[model samples]
Target: MRIEKEVSPEYEIPAVLQHIEARGRRPVLIFENVRNLNGTRSGLPVVINLFGARERLADALGTTVARLPLDYVAREKPLAPVVVDRAAAPVKQVVRTGADADLYELPVLTHHEMDLGPYLTSPSVWVRDLETGWTNCGILRVYVSGPRQMVVNFNIARHTFHYFQKYKAAKRDVPIVLVMGHHPAFYLGAQTKLLADEPHIIGGVMGEPLELAPSETWGSDIMVPAAADIVVEAEMSHSQLEIEGPFGEYTQYYGGQKLSPVAQVRAITRRKDAMYLDIMPGRADHLLLDAPMVEAYLYNRLKDVVPGVTAVHMPVSGTARLHAYIQMRKTNDGEPRTAIASALSSDYRLKHVVVVDEDVNIFDDAQVLWAIATRSQWDRDLLVLPGMMGTTLDPSADDILTAKGGIDATRPIDPHQFAMKLCIPEAVLSRVRLEDYLTPEGLRRL
Candidate 1:
């Protein structure tokens, strides 16, 4: 939870990666004097990889990773947001309007070679439903195109796009506030698949109420998180479109350029010493941010369909989107196949799913692979559905349609041979300690 602030003045995007590498998986980084492309220092500090590690994310939610789903489900009720005075809001400490609201002053990083330009990778986009006046918050990739303009990629499948469509239909510009830098729980809550109002409910579950402040341009009806380090007030024009992307995505591939919505910045508000946040696309930070949310969503969906579902894990190796592992207690003959089908149907982004017995550790790739290798029979256990709508980021897909498959890796219902795995007795395991058996030097070598 400690923020590292003694960053070198010359440090830039490459230096951030070097720091991550040097620290050997430190979860949070806060850099001061971040160098921009113009070889000048930005006054604002930068933060990256806030949720890069599993342990850090777990700590943020006040629970273990294995118990996050239960924790998330328990806090589904919305808590009304408390409106705070502009003076009481930390984010409103310094407000810039008109010409002073320049985006170039921020140290937004260019993450990869194929990326178009500096992107505000971790902005929590806030928008309201045109008809209902209900607020919606979610994370979207934004390309910084100009001082007062940015291009936003809105995938039609996401709720944010639906909200934008309503605004477009009404012939009105969509008012949005792109919030950056808050407690990790705020970011995690924003990513949740909510059936109701998200921001306050998520905050309530995280043991706090989300404080709100009125937008400078959008009025009191449109609120942004008061705790944010920086807030960009913008309006996505109903008719204007701009070329966005060719930026690296979580799928580890360049998301091709397409005509997308153009946002015109109206004002910028920040703390006097604002800390900018950026998510490294196609890296651990991006995957960790998305994976836990997907796992929680799948866990909730499967529990209703398959009552015996034990756990769900979207492995990091699969980029935490395209592949999934579901652990369940099998009682019936066709339960594994049923679980697989239900899981695949839960999320279109999932291209492959492996259903394993409760004995298998879904978090461990080796254990899941071992279960599939030993228990599965290709002809009988494999389930394939072709021409299904899938993630556009998947390179193998034919335009958004792709084949989906699943493996029933659980052992047979009345198994004789493959039912049990060999293990050491508890009595022997309890008495054994590697550190007690080895010398300090030997332990160090090991």
Candidate 2:
């Protein structure tokens, strides 16, 4: 929905989005009349909350929400990108360099109340690995410090940081491109856990080869998405590290100031009519992008050890990283402990795992919690491993090490071995339709 009312990039835009979120609506928002940082009306519209809904994300993969995780795992084959010339690239239509390429002209937004300042939340920063020559893509937070300078957090554990370390060792500045405003599938593909040429993985997720074009600064050596709405070509300094954040992160908390590499913007290219895309931090749009990939990876890993594993869900309550709920058909009493051990060791970021019977819905939090409460005693079923590697972003973590815990919330394999769960008869459920029992207006109210 396009809002014709005028808004500022400072706090107004994000405040409006927060209000919308409170009402439990995640519609794509277009701020048509937005004031840029320089207090000038922006020609380009700002797009927010594009990835807020699972149904839309599923649509991007050409699958249903229920099958999204499995579908993603099934389509992991790499497909090379097809390179196109500058003339054929939509993102190259309007190129600005030197003094004309001003970052202040764009409608960058400040998301949370305590956020440092306006940030570019959705750019997929691309850098080539020094040894392998593979292009690594990371959706990192960028703090726009000046008209031509920005600070990027090259996380030490991520592929970008690993490549950055090599560049630093060689004493060479890293050439990078911040790709913005591409299709949802493009971003989803970039979030794959597989350590490979990301464009190939992106193409496989897109179900075809992605189009690439020579970057304005590095030419053929560093190709970027040909159809991207906006591209910022820059060089990250190997020596210069700047203080970066106190910015709101995906964990629904502020990430304190830290030293990061400063990127000097060389050029800005975009379509004549482009949309500035922003991912609402600490919300569904920011978290859901990684959900499918994480769920798929965990599910595949669990299935290898336990064939009876039915599904896996990374709940939003855990920021889609720290926790997982696994559902399986248990064959023996020891299966739960085996699954718990395998799952906790599967991913470093996973701090908690809850294994339940197949009959319980893994997607529903209440059902999973209920199973935990009734199924087993804490002394026997609770699994805790201290001093495990975890994400540094986790506020609860002791730096990067955390205590991982799990609960085997499954009942006895035999139906009569444990107390039975209450359920309405299938005959009654099939016969008593809500539509038939209630008035049309009553149904609408419900």
Candidate 3:
């Protein structure tokens, strides 16, 4: 079958609720009928942002997000995903038309009070493979226009933008499909390291190929998630334009929305009872978007450079790819530098990198800082590469140039002086909890 239909969005909502209840983070799976400023409820439902949590992120890849690449699978030869036709596709169960297609009718939340309007958040957008004709599905945010249209903000120097630009240069509309709703992985797959053709990588992740249907809206060339909640098929024109954003972005910063290009959405196909995925911007949704993408690149690079670079943590709290900590064995002095260099080069978006010995879990910021404080002698251990590629969104890069830096946070080894700290037993903690020191009743007594 082109699409499998077992799980429901409702099943995933509780997981998000628990995450928010515990962490005070943002990752809402809104299944309710969405309304616009006009307050009109629509029958069609859409899933906005799927990259909302590390767990959901893993759910996207069909594995635990914490699982390192070394734990399973070999990339020696990636397996191709299986594909089927629209007849077997659950996403195409129902289809919306041009007149009936009122985008504002769907309750696309204005996540933060400052948003460009309701945007299409959970789209594993499919485009033609640059090399072959295979379709490449990647999560990209497309802004909603009035009736039957969206404005895609493909961003400067992005691969998607480049692909569309190729078509734009030729005065052709880039045939595309924004898979409205699907597993978190569909979005995660799109955020993957841009290496070879990625549609096949989706096959590798699914352990099978996807079923696809020819986009009737586009002339025979476009195909999409057959089971998508919506397939917004439209073409572009040099004449069409609109002022778009003022939305909260992944950086947890407000980007004043501006005018962008326009495309007329001719057709939208979906499951009759499809779930709309909405990821409130400026929350975990934004951070998780780039984490695994950054992780995948680090995983591959570190493995080749460091002898046993088991894991790498680009802490979400660190703004996705900006700051990263790499876990590697203390093979020698060169390995840490190699890891740092690999990380800096792998992700142009990064600000700093801290490489540490295997004894230190890179995920622990305190431990990493501890290593930096004690073992590192600032001038000697640090490495800074100026004029390298990095994200302009970075406040540090506000100098308006591509600048980057990294730290070999690992201890310059003097094997004899090393000592591992001992930890108190958990049983002891159970015997004497924090309540003993600061009790609700005792506080008043004090």
Judged by whole-model lDDT over C-alpha atoms, candidate 1 comes out at 0.83
lDDT of 1 by residue, 1-446 (tens): 33344443332554566576566665566666676534567777777777777888888878887887667657655777788999999999999888888888788788777778778889988888877777777888898899889998878778888898888888999898999988888887888677457776667666678999888996787898898999999988899998887888888899889999899899999998788888877878888887887888788789888888999999878999999999999788688788888888889999999999888999999999999899899999999999998988999999889999999998877767555789999999999999989999999977
- Find the candidate with the highest TM-score and give its number: 2
lDDT of 2 by residue, 1-446 (tens): 89999899988888888899899888999999898889999888999999998889999989998799999878877998999999999999999998888999999998878887889999999999999999888898899999999999867778999999999999999999999999899999888778999999889988889999998888888898999999999999999999988999878988889999999999999999999999989888898989999999888888998999999998888888888999999889888888888988988889899999988998889999899999979999999999999878889899989999999999977879898789999999889989888999999988
Candidate 3, 1-446: lDDT as tens digits:
01122223322333444455476554444445444435655544434445555776555455675683332233212455445676787766776767765665555555555666667766676667444565556666678767677887767655666666666666766666677666544455555555546666655555556456666576446666665566666665434668778766767776756666787777777777877666655556667666765676678777877767878788867776688888877767888777788888886677788887777867668888887887677687888888787776666575436666667767556766665556788898679855678979887765
Ten contiguous residues minimizing lDDT sum, candidate 1: 2-11
> How far in Å is the alpha carbon of 304 misplaced in model 2?
1.3
lDDT of 1 at 70: 69
Q: What is the lDDT of residue 88 in candidate 1?
A: 94
Q: Report the error of model 2 at residue 396, Å.
A: 2.6
Model 3 lDDT vs. the true structure? 0.64
Report lDDT (Cα) of residue 430, candidate 3. Answer: 75
